[model samples]
Every structure is written in C-alpha cells, then in structure tokens.
Target: MAPKVTYSDLVIIGAGPAGLMAAAWASRLGLNARILDDKVDRVQTGRADGLHVRTLEILDSFGLANAINEKAYQLREICSWVRAARLPLRAGYADCDKNPDPEDDSKIKRTERVRAKEEEHGRFCQLGIHQGFIEQNFIDFLRREGRLNVERNTATKSLQLDEALMSDHAAYPICLRIGRSTVTMNGDTADQGWRSPQEEIIKARYLVGADGGHSWTRDQVGIRLEGGKTKVHFGVVDIVPITDFPDIRISCSIHSTKTGSTMTFPREDRLVRFYVQLAETGSEGDDFDTSKVTPEMITEKASKILSPYKLSYKHCNWWSVYTVGQQCAPSFSKDGRVFLVGDAVHTHSPTMGAGMNVSMQDSYNLVWKLGQVIKGIAKPDILDTYNAERQSVAQTLIEMDREMCDFYEKGAGSDAHNYDEFYERFRTFLSGVGVEYGPNALVVPAREDGSRDSRSCTDLDKSRQTRGFSRRSLASKIPIGQRLPSFLVLNHSEANIVHVHSVLPADGRWRLLVLAGDISKASQMARLRILCERMDAPSSFLRTYTPEGDKVDSVIEVVTIHAAPRHKVELFSLPELLRPFDPKLGYDYWKCFANNNAGEEGDFDDAYAKWGVDKDEGCLIVIRPDQHVSLVCGLQEVEEVEQFFNTILVPQQRRKATAAACE
Candidate 1:
C-alpha cells in the first residue's frame, strides 16, 4: 500500500524539552498534535535539569509543582571558593577565613557563602532534578488526560510546504515523509535495535522544529545560526562522591589559580554534578576533541580544583563534554507556518542552566496562540507575534549566555572580577522572571489612549515608549508586558487564604480581574456594577466571542478581588456574570476574593500596595493565558477592554461558521 497517511493540527519534530513542552501545551489546549523523534526511547539521564522560579510557577499552575517539590533537590544557597593565598582584588571575594596558614596561597578555601538570590522571594526558587524526570512528568500528564503520545523511532525523511496554502487557515500546508523502525534484534543496543523501516506521510496545519542545536528541520527551512563558538571546553560528570569535599552537598563555584574552575550542583538522589574546565590539548580550531575526555578526566580536573579536600566518586551516573558557544537564529518562524523553538532557535553554553528553561518557555509562549488560531478563537495574524516576541527573548538569552561564558573562562584571572555584582545584574533574568515581551498583537503598548502604534514591535533595542495615559504608573510595580506578580488573598466564601495566581491556571483563557477598591463604599461598588453590566450585555466581547451555547466564562474568565472584609461580602452577592451559575457546577464561589488580612498573613496590603492600586480607585487588568499582564485600565474603561479583544478575538457567530466549514 502507499505510505500510510495521517493528519494533525500541529506536528512537532523532536521529543526533547522544547518539543515535549509544545506537546503539553497542545494537549492542554485540546489540539490534535503529533510529536515525533528518531530516538527509540525517552532521555535516560544527564541533560537539562535545573528548574527556575518562573518555571516552577508554571508547574504550580498545572498542579505539578508539589510533585516536583517532592522529588527534586532544592537549591537554596550558593557558596564560592578560591585559592587561599592573596588573590587578585576581586570585589566580591574576601580572603578565606578557613585558611589554616595565612601565608599558604596554594590551597583552595571558601571565599563566600550567600543565600540563593532566587530564594529571596517567590513561592519557589531553584530546583535540581534530572531531565528525564521532567520529561516523564509531561508524558504522564498527557497520558492521564488521554491526549496525544509521542511517536518515537520515527525519522523524518523530508518536508515540503505548499506556499499557496500557507495563507489558508483550513489547509494542512506542511507535509512530511518519515520512516519508522520495523525490526529489532533481541540483544541490540539503542542505536542497533532498528533494522528496516516503514514509510509514512503526515500533513499538518503547522510544524515546529524543536529538534536540537544541530536541527535538521531548521536546515531544511533554510535558516542559519549566526555566531561563533568560544574556545573554552568543559567536561561534565554526575556522580556520587566518595570524598570529603567541604561543600560537596552544596552548590558551589570553585576557582583555582593553576587548576582552572569547577562548578558544583547538588542534585537529587545524593548525586552531584561537576562542570570542570578542561585545559586545551591538541585540538583543532573551534572543536574540542571530546573523545579524549572521560569521566575520569573530569573527576581529575575537579579533584585538582578541590586541593586539600580529597574528591572521588563511588559511582558515576553520567558524563559528557561540551564547548562554550553562542548562536541564535535571526528569526524564529518561516512564513508563520513553520516555527523553531528551544535549541533550534538559539544555542549557548549550558553554564546558566537556561537552555531547558528558555527552550520550554518558547513553546509555552507559542502553542497557546497556535491553538487559538486553529480553533478560530483568534485572528491568524496573532501567530506572527510568536516570532516578534520569542526571537527577542532568544537574542537576550544569547547575550546573557555570552556574558556567563566569559566570566567562567576569565573571571579567575582578572583582578576586576566581581561575581557578586555579575550575579546581581542577571538574577531576575536567570530566574526566568524578568522576561518581558514588547507591544505586539497580543501585548498592548503602554499608552494612555489604548491605541496601537505603527512602529516595529520586534526591535528590542528601542526604549519603551512612555507617552499618553501612562498605564505603567497606575500599577507602578506591574509592568504591562511581564508576568503578573502574585500576592495572597482570601476566598470570599471559605475565608481561606490563597495565592492570586493559583486561580489563573494555564487553560488558554484570558483573565479579567476587577480590583474593586473598598467595595463597602457606594461609589466603588457602583463603578464595579457598571462594569459588570457592560460585561454581561449581549454585545459584550465575552458573549460575542464565546461560541453559542458555551459557558459565559469559557473564553474570558472574570475574577473579582475586593478591598472589603471577607465576612462583609457574600460570594452570591457579586454580579451573576462574575459568579456564573451552572446546573451541574452551581455558582463559581472561587471567582470572588477579598483582601481580608486573615491568618495574620499580612497579604491584604501585599495585594493592594504591592499591586500599586489604591483601595478607593480600583483598576482593571487583563492577563494572558501564560500569566503575562497584557493591559491595565481603570475599572470604568469597559470600552478599552472590548477594543482590546476586538483586535484579536473572532465573533462567536463567525467563529462557529469557520470552524464548521473547516471540518
């Protein structure tokens, strides 16, 4: 028979972090997706493992944070060590207090020990878990939801896209020819298990190239990675130590005057990861011969850096070699149909522990938009914003990676080396919380009039425009394009305290929050009522865009937070639109919250003051599905809310017709 034919709403090549994230988002959004990888099985061990604060926040939204917290090792502190002798005058490093002999400069000793910057605030800071465990979580979630499963042992032979059909929303414009392993021997290895292959064909509405740094899909799309690699190479090993290294159980940065530098990561299951700087050998330009390196070699380098403290491993879990490099794609998408994410779009040293975090975030940002367009809930042009937004992030990531590589290579030798200052500068970005998208189809520019500007949204170099009504000042702490900062509040019905973001799950629905200041006052309550009247009207965007016969809060979820005592406001007293009732689900008592200072938790002022919104004049805020703030407006600016949705959402009447016709 001819090659078996299949179809998918989205097809992703690669089952790594990025591809798995894309699959997770697609499954969550109810999209028909197919994820394929040539590897026969899941990642067994040794890859991207560090999870940043924002990434943990994302997992919490999905109800997976607790599980991760149980299994992963928490990294709450970092310690730095250097030569005990009189060192160069680096601002961050003071002389080692633990040095036995003041004049002995030959031994390594502790220089500084400080709390992890990420632990200063936020619900979670940093975690050390194996990449395989993370991937398995995504797999388990997909399987539990009865969604798509990854197709492994499948190799893509070629790909083709019909240019004319690219603009057609209903067309499966991208086509791929692939092969799967058909036979395996009883004792064959992972690579030798496959003998022959059966061919297959897949046609998809959209395609994602999340393969890796050497992405075949990226090459097929004619995109070139722009940048060069650094000459510095590093040997990485994960092992259970057998020696008495002082900070073996803690994350540390050790710099030696003669032996080079080593970074230590305390991981789950008592395993420690050591990244040891390798000395140059007989290697060609730009290429470090990893074949000449081994776990023994890596351990030797690490032992040299440790000095007086003995270091060896009873068991070695994994080992590899890598060169520090920086390269990024000029753009992330081809014709808005074929997109690249993760390492496919950017490549850098793994020193920052950002490769997997940034890569997974790219898919987290893109797939929701794709689901909206595919389901006829949003305009097709919104897909263009994916490139405009993520490419800028990729460029920033490349720059940050370059800086990290430079520090690791040269920080030990330079007198001006200040790791403390360097760490402080990029702490927020490194935690994955400082990322901000510019004005685009999805993010409204910070202007008073709520108007769209004709300037290039993709240019990250331009300073943000600060003109017109100045929405940024309304909530001085909440930047419009960044993730919404979380605070605690009391549930109006149960008087139970909860984090504000726990209510804003990753369900692909826009959030409209009404911060009605001091609702006990007649004026504030009156303003909230008027806004509710507009939201409940027949012509409102909530009704106009939500499909016929669907729940009112399906597309846009309305949540109310009042600056009134929890006991004063009954959940049922809120407008019907805010607490919509259903025959099966009853009224949504969880939608309304009160800023009552319950449990002496001190979260009431945190909600009002930290948000920078006055209790007397409440403001309205719009949050994207990914928890990023899109718009901030006055409570009475109902028209502005409607206008913002009009630019993106399709009317329910037209959306249903389009979806039916496509079917």
Candidate 2:
C-alpha cells in the first residue's frame, strides 16, 4: 500500500529548549512547521537554568523578553572560594573532602563574586530562568505569533533524503517518518509500553535535530562526538534549604580543601541549587554506574561537603548526576537538507552554565537561514555557514570549559592560581556575546584603503578563535559581522527614545540602513535621491527580490537615519520608499530617523559622529536578520549596494497574477 503522506515546510525534532526556539523562529518567518518529541510533556524541573546576556538579547529580538523577565530569577554575582576549615562536616562526608586543615578557613576567606561580562544589546545582563518556563514561553509565542502547536509523543522513526527531489530547489528533499510512541485517548496516555510502525510520512524541505545530547537524530546522521570522558562527575540538586549557611541566598562556589568543589546557584521562589562534586564517579573508565546513583546520594554528599557550616534541606526539588565530558560533532549538517543543532553538536561540563545558553543560540543562528531558504528569498548555499560558524563556536566553548575545569581542580587563591585571568579572558563566552563569523558572502569588511569589499560568499571561518564579532573602523564606530550595537535614538515621527536595536527587531528581515548624511546639504540630498530611485526601480534588487505579493521592502527593509536635524526633514518631504505606505495602514513612520543634532534631548543627535559617519558624506550598511553587519558601501555607490544583496539573496521573479494587485 502507498504510505500515508503529509507535507510541511519544516520539521523539528525534540521539543526541548532548542527545538522550541527553532519552532518559534519558524513561526516568526511564517513557515508551516511542526515540533515533535517522544516525551509526552515538558520536563518538570532540574535542567538548564542559566540565561546569559546574549541569549536575553536574542529573546528581545523575538519580542518575548518582557514576558520571560517577569517570571525568572536574576543572578547578579557568582562568588567562588575554598573551604579548608577542618571543623568536621556532618555525617554526610564519609567519602568526600580527602583532607582538611584544622583551622585554615583562609581558603574560604578570600571570596570573589564573578560578574559575567556585559553587552550593550543584552539589557537583562544575566538571569537564572527555569528551562521549562523557557519552553512554555516559546510555545505561547508559537501559538500567538505563528498559530502553531507541538505534536507531542511523536517519535521520528526514520529520515532519509529524496535525491530525486533534491534537484528541485523548491521541493521537500528530506522525508521523515513519524508516529505516536504511546497511544493516548483524550490527551492521556493509555499504554505505558506500545509500538507502531510509521503511521505518516512527513515531506519536509528541511529537518532539524535539536533533539539533545544523546540525540537519536545525531546517531541517525552517523556524526561522531569527538572527546573522551574526563575524571569529573557531578551530582546536581535543586532545593529549598533550612540551614545555617550564610551564603545560601547568594550564588557561591565552595571549594573544599579535600571535599572537591560545590557550585551554588540562586534561583526563583527562594529555591537554591548546589552542584555537589561526586569523587566516586571520577572518569569514564572508572567502575561507576549512573543508574545506581540516587537523589539521596546527591543530597547526602552535598551535606558532607558543607562541613563546618551545617547544611541540610527540608525540600528537594530535583536531582541528577552526570559525568562531565567535552565533545563536538565533526559536522553539523549533511547535504544542506538535514541538520543537527544544540546538544546534538556539542556537550561539555556545566561548570560555567554554558549548556542551554549555547544550545538556544545554535537554534537562533539556524532557523532564520532555513526560513529564508524555504521562502526562496535566499540561496540554499547560505545553509553552508551554519556548521562552520557554529562548530567553531562549539570547539571554542569546549576548550574554555576544559580550562575552567583545570583551575577548579587546582584551587583558587593568590598562591594557587590566577582563576580571574582565565575567567576574564572568556568573559564574553559566558555572556553569550562571544560569537563572531568572519568575512564571507554575508559579512563584508572595510577595505584597507578605505574601500568596500564586494567579494561573493566564501566559507571562511574568520571567527574560529571564539572571539566576538568583527567591527568595521567606520567613523560611525559600527562593527561589521556583529549585532548592530545599541545607541539611543528617537523615532523621527513618534519622538520616542529607545535603543537603536529596539527599532530593528529580529523578525527575519534584512535591514538596509540608509545613513543619509546631513540631508540639508545639496550633495547629500542628491546622493539620497539617487539611491532612493535605484531602490524604487522595477529591476532593482530590493524591488525584484522580494517574495511574491510582498512589498518591495518586505524582505530588505530600508530605514533612514540622516544627520540633518529632525525638525528640518518632515515626513512628507521624503519619498514613499523611505517611509512606505500601506493603503490600509497609511504611512510607515518607523523607518526614518535623524542624528538628533538639535540636542533637544541631550547627545541623542550625535549618531553621525557616534556612528563614525561624516556629516558631509554618509554610507550604506546592510544587516542580517540576526543583526550582524553584512556590508558597508559608499553613500552614492548604488551599484555596489545592489551587488551586496545579489551576492546572497535569490531575487524572486514577479509572476503575472490572475488579477492586477495595486501597489
């Protein structure tokens, strides 16, 4: 019999934090997608809990920052020190803390609280939100923004590429078969154990395996995680403690002189977390059984590690033990149709809370590229950057984690090791702003002789060192290949004050920042008009590349920021292209801006000088949907600007519709 068939623009496996993010972005880009997982419902507790600053900024672009901020815990400082006072811990320390000095509490005396590096775009700094709530927020956004839902309890039985369909760029090349793992009635599972062959065939243009660390999807792709298990095993427990420990309310890492290291994390609802070091499960070759480890063992070990200062909990929220191992997949994608993301690509120790933050970031970088490809706005080749950019980051994180683990074992103090130096070196990594992709089709750098590079896309991993995004030495001080930095600017029409990034939301649309120099000058005005004419031309990249039935600026929005005083350029004087109009919506007021040179509200007008743009001659900047800078061209170089878009975008040919549609 012919197999049951279904069709979707995208199929995402594993409805965990990473999967939910991919689904949310698909919804944002208007892709018809479904999220699936073998699990019946979201995990209740005890999972990734750190939301670094950069992750929060990504959330801001998704327009879900306010909703998440209201329900999460804020961890401002991470304190670390050693506990060497041998006052004797409670009965919980039988096999922990090898040796302790009788009165050397100095190990715990010099305590230092670590404040993660900051980013201008990441306003929240850092938060300790629960993973479940993070998933729920994405679900709510999926329902509200994309009108989509997750298909729970559905396991992907198999997936293979349809090479016959591969030739057709528009067709779904990846075919996936899925079925409900456990039969259910009225949203309740009836059979605890059940089996079924593939009940449906999902033809998908793209498939994402955001499945997780032990992802079946990863195994299906035959990608190997290259890393050996280290001698560090940790038991983590989240609880509400009733104890005499003074640092219970604050985040702290207590390094026992002999009991190993215990990491403390402050969470929401007065709940605290402790990463208890388990010396018994040292390395992968050790005679240890994770199945035999219990929550009782974790809490008991935590108690003994506390020692001199009594420690116990009246409530235990959740517990788990994991052997720390650093590993990364050799490749993140195959044939540009099937891909792996999040934990599927890398896994390492959670010493610095890098697990979930990096996972969500992987999905954030991927979904938008896939969305544009499926929408026919971008070429399939854009998918090539996914693995190269992200894998480099994965490798960087592994090395950083290994470095931190080394210091954790060496002990912290003036005489022991300079833990602060190592921590400061990777300050941006923990903050999530350390990702920077090098020059390629998407990222254009300023030429050495002050000219713009017009080269097409190449798979160059310039950011392979795990450094932050590269910045152009533009007088405007804008950094190329990095998120558009934030500066306060007013809405030309609304007279409102907000960060420059707030106006440029991450809705999967490229931004053409037409930084028109002082519009009052004749030369600047002439240049602006010429660029506008090119943008408005029928054969122009902006006009021709937009998806069918969409406006010229739909895919590549043109927002104007001029150095002229806001009072001088009224909204009516400029072309409709700058401030576009929808017949039903009237005029678009958000696209135009001035440097605020009038200084009516302080230095908000110094954008020209602050951005490093000349008041006499401005330049054009192209920003990716992820907010990284792509190109910077001369103000009057209209052809160069066109080539920038033509390099990566596949211009959509306008088809003769059955009926004429008014612009």
How close is every model to the real structure, measured as TM-score?
Answer: 0.93, 0.88
List candidate 1 stretches off by more than 4 Å: 84-102, 183-197, 281-284, 412-414, 448-470, 596-605, 657-663
Q: Which candidate should be chosen as best, given TM-score against the real structure?
A: 1
TM-score, structure 2 vs. true: 0.88
**Candidate 1: TM-score?**
0.93
- Per lDDT, the best of the predicted structures is 1
Model 1: per-residue Cα lDDT over 159-229, one tens digit each: 99999898898899998988776434332122333333377889999999999998989999999999877
Q: Residue 460 CA error for candidate 1 (Å)?
A: 11
Q: Which residue pairs clash in candidate 1?
A: 85-105, 448-469
